[model samples]
Target chain A: MKKVGIVTGGTTKFTKTDISIESLLVSAIKQIFDNSSNLSQKDVDVVLTSTNANNKYLANITSELSGMAPKIAHSVESLCNSGTNCIVSAYAYISSGLADVALVAGAEKTDSPGLVLDWDKSRGQYKHPIYWSSMFTSAHKRKFGTTLEDLAYVGANNHRNALDTPYAYFEKPFSVEEIMESKPLTENLRLLDCSMPCNGSAAILLASENVIKNFCEQPIWMTGIGQKAISASFTKNDDLTSMKSTILSASDAYKMSKKAAEDIDAAELHDAFSICEIIELEDLGLVPKGEGGSYVRRLYDTKDRKINPRGGLIGTGHPLGATGIAQTIEICQQLQGKAGKRQIDGAKTGLIHNMSAAATSSTVLILES
Target chain B: MNKFEQELRNGNFVCGECSKCNKLVWPPSDLCNNCFNNVKWRPISKIAKLVEFSSKNDEYFCIAEFENQIRVMGKVENILNLHVGQTLTLVKCGFDGKEIFVFGLGD
Candidate 1:
């Protein structure tokens, strides 16, 4: 119950054209300078980092450019929720008076060590439970009518949204038919069904009312955050598609934010597949169950509330660990009224909900400017 | 395999955890959604339901119910046109683990 919250420090520049997970992060810190109007990187106290790539070397990279190294620099591994997790962890530290000025950053270069490296080979965050393979999904496909196209619809739609995002990976638009015709990775899930692998980084600086006044002018407020975990037995689950993680996470986020699902004006959902978003809409309560996909189609057909708005993972890119933080960046951008062309009109409140392990791990955050 | 026996034995079940929300999950953690904390390590259950199923040459798993709220989605367990509620066990589970579950069609 500590008075823990984040300030909207700034948003910097990044583009896949020459995207460096490290550089993006460096630029993000530079933003503290650009928007703070007076603060210097030397004014920061500590640093927190998150990523899901073989590039565990980023810690050295972030500190290199910022000039002054922090007292503590570490990495978090939460698949997609690392950003929010970093923020939450920072909130805990700040609220406790552990650090006055903290910088939270996330970035990943999925372009290296291709994602094909499965869980069994992982050392730190690499060890995965059984059923982490495409074989399991493939097995289901052999028995069901499910096809890769079902997954591609999400990628195509996400990419369509990415067309508007300058930082997105595949900014070019794609059609459902093109995605369907693309290469297959696993059963039902095509290469397109999966999130695009790319390189990018995002960073946010947090300050107490004391330190922040000297550095930030328009600090993006960290309004509410929550996290949860479930037992990790896939077969023991009652429903494969029903996300207990999402509902449970939202349960905490909604309670903390004092808001309902209906109140969220915009969202940045981790759409690893076309269906991921469809199911997420229902899981997040933005849409009714079963009808989620239909609503996606409806929205796409009309080109209205393009969910990813910034072109989702399908369009922008899915740098594993980076996606979650990037999603937060998008949410922060939306709430701060700086999303420009892709901005959700009058977006006073927003959320970034990402899932991992086929909807097992979830993270939800409610943001306000 | 006998009904209860297959439900108890047979093998080949998937397990996972919902790190996002702390829900006891069956299909392991490629994703944990509790406030979207990111996927993490947790105990996953090899247990599940056949709920109500059907037979077909094609594989599929789907179920849409209005029991409590709105529940829909299914799967095709490989080559089997598994009857509704057919208990299944994993012959192979993950990189090094497995368990069993009830598909749940009591016939």
Candidate 2:
């Protein structure tokens, strides 16, 4: 397979706004060009957009506004993991010689579907993801003796980490006591345990190895990528405590990259909820099974692990389609030692984990500098 | 209303049974999830075990498992200290005419 590398990335501030998705995409694209003097709109061979907005023809619209007529232009939608899936698609396109330079951008409004709990035909009135997360947390508590305090630590750590993240939505740190005392969205999940839904956009530029030599001085290589869709319905899942999609996808990525969980130096995981960070760590083999809570506590106490140096979705605000792209950008930044205050020392290899819809679908990517 | 919704309105909990592989399908689909064969609707066991439950603002929700590998999500009629593996019986099933399936549980 032809090798693909990330040339540069750009992100919009994560917050609630009335800006149109098109404008967000344009802005993100403009940021990419502004950051890299080597790249221009005319050099882009493909453009892909991912969003859950009601707008149509996003790819064509973005291309037109950005003043590029690329051979491939389309939109991708896979709920929250749409951004990662778009990158995966672009990677495939470049590896298959379909394009030399590809641009992938994701944007989502605060009111995107699946962000809010709504009355659904099949799942009844309790269709919010909190119900599913609550079940997972409760089951984890019963199986592993994970305490409410453990969950609180997860939220507190992410909030504290966000203090240094420039684009994070909530920069102020909340103590563990404050997180535990926050209003309960469910029996086990409190207001602080959940990630806020906001508006945002992020973009990444991918170039083939041949194209990178001409314009890029530093490139983060996309070594391995794995994506899996387990089950759309929560009831169809075999286990509630673990995300099988993450396990399967991460395994595929690790196998392709010829690396184990220990080889990764830093990571950007989809912490849509506090419990998700814990569960994903275990599922990705970063920590042993049923030790996610303990692992998080250790990270919090020692400040050693560079997990979610960008504060993840919980602190950065979850904008659905833009979230996974932002995760990729964070990992890229870390691998390049450009994450500023939150940068992990001596970071060489990194991983990104993003999932959607009750952990039914997942995308895992391994990057190396 | 569709057949599945009609059955639920009649106070019956039914799921699809695969004609080829004999696997049970929940949430009522036209094709079996395992074999992709035409599915036939059949009444499932009224008895189930609570797998997990949560309450918010005095509203209780539960995930219950039944025979033939069917798990249904529903509301608990009586609020109680529920535990995993607790036995529950299906009290009623119906649609609220707004396309939401309401599954009522009993002790």
lDDT of each: 0.59, 0.85
lDDT of 2 by residue, A1-369 (tens): 799999888998888868999999998999889888877788899999999887999999999999999999999998889999999999999999989999999999988975742433335555778888888888888888888889888888888888888888887998899999999888889999999999889999999998986556889999978899976767666787899999999999999999889999999999888989999999999999899999889888987547888888888899888999999998998998898988899999999999988787999999999
Error of 2 at A271 (Å): 0.9
Task: Name every residue pair that clashes in candidate 2.
Answer: none
Docking class of 1: incorrect
Q: What is each candidate's DockQ, to 2 decimals? A: 0.06, 0.54
Interface RMSD of each: 12.0, 2.5
- Predicted candidate 2, C-alpha RMSD: 2.0
Those runs of model 2 whose alpha carbons end farther than 4 Å from true positions after fitting are A116-122, B97-107
Model number with the top TM-score:
2
lDDT of 1 by residue, B1-107 (tens): 22222322433322233455655322233554444444444322333334433222343333322212212233334544555445443223222222212222322
Candidate 1 stretches greater than 4 Å from native: A1-24, A54-61, A111-153, B1-80, B87-107
lDDT of 1: 0.59
Candidate 1 local lDDT, residue B90: 22
Docking class of 2: medium
Q: lDDT tens digits, residues A85-151, model 1?
A: 7777777777778777777777666554424324321111122221232333333334433345555
